[model samples]
Target: MRYLAAYGGENNVKAGMLHYFMYPSNDISVMPKEFLEERNATNHSNIGEKTLKKSIDIYWELYKVKGRLQ
Candidate 1:
């Protein structure tokens, strides 16, 4: 949590927390639809597709869950 937020902009902290909690395997799939939608719309450039991909990888590793994050 702290590591991911280390390089994040101050204003992005809230979004980062939401991102971590909303990641797949949290058993809250439908809950974060709006957050994901908003994030895709707003942070595409800031976080970028590559970063999101990396996030997916990290999520899998962190939770030890299988399947795709997309």
Candidate 2:
């Protein structure tokens, strides 16, 4: 979390957090639909999509969840 916030803009990081909520924070899916609608709005360019995608690709092998940060 620290590393992500340090590298990814904090706001975008939160967006990612919500996107990956299935990890544990997935309860966010229950939030108002209006909020969930923002899911496609985040773009954490500083976090490097290449690296982020790689990490997620690996994690996706073990866990099947939905949502994209950008």
Which numbered prediction scores highest in lDDT against the true structure? 2
For candidate 2, the TM-score is 0.28
Q: Can you write out model 1's per-residue Cα lDDT over 1-70, one digit (the tens) per residue?
A: 4423342543344355446444533233333556656554232135655676566566535743235355
| CA displacement after TM-score superposition, residue 40 of candidate 1 (Å) | 14
The lDDT for every candidate, in the order shown, is 0.45, 0.46
Q: Model 1, which residues run further than 4 Å from truth?
A: 1-29, 32-45, 66-70
State TM-scores per candidate: 0.31, 0.28
**lDDT accuracy of residue 32 in candidate 1:** 50
- For candidate 2, the lDDT comes to 0.46
What is candidate 2's lDDT per residue for 1-70, written digit by digit as tens? Answer: 3325333654454455445542433243334456656663334246565666666556544443234444
Model 2: per-residue Cα lDDT at residue 24 = 31
